[model samples]
Target chain A: MNNEMKLSFSSYSSNESFARATVAAFVAQLDPTIEELSDLKTAVSEAVTNCIVHAYRDAIGMVYITASISKDRRITVKIRDKGCGIPDIAKAMEPLFSTGGEERAGLGFSVMESFTDSLRVRSKVGQGTTIIMHKKLAGRLSGFAR
Target chain B: MGVRFVLKDDHLTAILSGEIDHHAASGMREEIDRKAGQAKPKLLTLDFSQVTFMDSSGIGLIMGRYRLMQALRGSLTVLDLSQQMKRVVNLSGVGQLVPLENSRPPRKPKASAKSKPKETIPETVEQEPPQPEEESRDIYSHSEWENQEKKEVMVHE
Candidate 1:
């Protein structure tokens, strides 16, 4: 894992897009296709969003995002936030089962799952939550910019 | 985002623009239901060409509208979906419920006789998508961004 490319920010929705854009740029070195890159961005957005809405709940918190290119040219992201952790990981993973008020669909995890091949969540009540996602890039595909 | 409706004869057109996340669902339902009941148009059109982005909550909103129109013996259609928006609708199986049509001026709605019930609060507030802009974006750098097409696993744990 390359440590220099990693970045961190406060957990918020606006910053979710920023994180996505930033990670998409860093992963450009892997020469990902448009669909592949979009997948990465969407996955990252979902994970970061979950942290902001469910974990921090508008409270001030820090979200860490790290992007690394594997030997096989895969892009990996680790999004972590120190906020209210998920009490029931199983229920939280269910589609359409959101714990938010009128303004949340609880589909963040589902969207993340749809866009990426691997998604793992680890959370402890009152501690924090960490989501690790991974995606592989096509070696032959090139010409993307960072 | 709040949606406005312009009723003309038998056609009821909803002009909507904004992010359709969980937060917008309630306002959308109230406005749409109110207009649909008042106009009782034979055709319901949801213009989305102006919408920038939408998520699953948007799907639920459309579904609620579809049910409302079906009760009124009217059909619903969406117009002017961008490529990404279209993909979202398609992926969510919304296309199976209401077909997409090319953009044109609001069509004349066929007159209806049935009166729509007063707007109620049955539809509860749902989930909201992450805001388009938030602070967690500092994770990646602009210099590292690459825009290439590669076929590989998108992500892993």
Candidate 2:
């Protein structure tokens, strides 16, 4: 089973929910259980929120989120942002490293890493950042998202 | 963000509803801080029973309140944490700081087929359904994205 898509939206705080819902509804195609759907939604939210808060900061930008489902029932999600990228990807991924200051929990990347099967970050300081996540799901509801 | 407050002497309990994200977090932080300032509660309890979703922003909201309490010489407690909320607070390291009313974390659903990781992040940063946007989104189906040639998957074997 094969499905894929590319979406681009303004990096507005309001769009955070929009982005998560898009990926959730699309990944629902693979007929994931409620638990699986929740996992995907959380991961997407962190990535998109980062784009709105840290990446774009005070300026406006765009975020690109893509999704795909393989025959193996493995789901892949890509969240791309062309705003100011992360300087230290590893430090950013740390559980307690947040640029949002004490007012921020800095758990964005940590949550992303924990929820997804495996997380990968690629970016250059001024170029942008892309977060890729994958997970092999279990079970499938017949005649769902077909 | 549907939040109401219950003021009981030295305690102010905030009953928060809906999924909390950056957008909701901002407004909530203001509302709670203002009311806490006016009421001057010795303990601010954020009631999460009605809250179905929260992201890092939710964590930030808690941290801010904790700091506010500390400065005011008060304390903060988060009560009625759902299992999903428990997992998040556990991960964020805030579960230890905020006194959870529930002694034991909620049990997760049983794993299916292969043994998946016991740890699961709530849907999208614990993605409960995201907040609504000004533009009405169309009813989406999986087929809308069927079979696009663009495929990018990064795996670290």
Candidate 3:
């Protein structure tokens, strides 16, 4: 089964939940386990948060998210923002590195990496940042299968 | 998200409910800190039984509250975390800093029973020595991070 979805919303903190929920609902068709679903939701939340907090900073921008499920139950989610980009992607991905000041935990990238099977980050100094993550859902035997 | 505080003696428990993402975490952090600071309790308990969902932002919330309690000369304990939430907390190495109390049931205040001691705060606050950050594993290579696929799709509003 193949499915895909795309969403764009303002970079408001309130929309963070919206983004993750939308992705989860779309992925629900694949019949993911509760733990798998939660992991995907957390990865989505972390990526969207980076867009809202780090990418846009104080200015309001738009966050674009695209999610798709492949035939083998592989889920791919792409989150993008056209705001201030990270100069050092490697450092930003570190466990406790945060440029968002004291209130921020700087664990966003680390969480995303750990939750998702694959994580890729691309950014230009002044352009924007894009995070792509992939997670494979376990194939459960259907009760109807002979 | 909402937080309900229950204060008995010098112990304060903040029962957190709803999803704790970045959006809700900031508000919850400010509220918890303000209440904990003003009360200056000897022990601060963060009850996560009511929390339905949490992300890395929850880690920040816990770490910040731990620092606040430390400044106030108090100890912090996390209670009743869901299994999924516990995974995120453990991944951040927060369990090493704050006590993750999930094995036992939460203490309830007795109405008429006086045999049990009223004191809830533990006599000794276990302080684990901070360990050095683990070296970055070769779970994935730097070249893998460089691989990228860009797709442009239009969304109809």
First chain TM-score for all predictions:
0.90, 0.93, 0.94
Using DockQ as the yardstick, the better of models 1 and 3 is 3
Structural similarity to truth (TM-score) of each candidate: 0.62, 0.80, 0.80
Output the worst ten-in-a-row residue range by lDDT, candidate 2 chain A.
A137-146
Tell me candidate 3's fraction of native contacts, as a decimal between 0 and 1. Answer: 0.65
| C-alpha-based local distance difference test score of model 1 | 0.69
Worst 10 residues of 2 chain B by lDDT: B148-157
> Model 1: per-residue lDDT, tens digit, B12-32?
889888755544556787888
Best by lDDT: 3
lDDT tens digits, residue span B18-99, model 2: 8888877888888899999999999999988788777778888888999999999999998877655666667877777878
Per-model interface RMSD values are 5.4, 6.7, 8.5
- What fraction of the correct interface contacts does each predicted structure contain? 0.11, 0.61, 0.65
Q: Candidate 1 chain B — worst ten consecutive residues by lDDT sum?
A: B107-116
- Measured with C-alpha atoms, the lDDT of residue B134 in candidate 3 is 21
Cα error, residue B129 of model 2, in Å, equals 30
Candidate 3's residue-wise lDDT over B1-157, tens digit each? 6899999999999999999998999889888988997899999999998898999889889998988999999999999887789888877777998988864443222211232355465534222222222213123245543431110010000
The alpha-carbon deviation from the true structure for residue A125 of candidate 3, after best TM-score superposition, in angstroms, is 1.7
lDDT of 3 at A72: 78
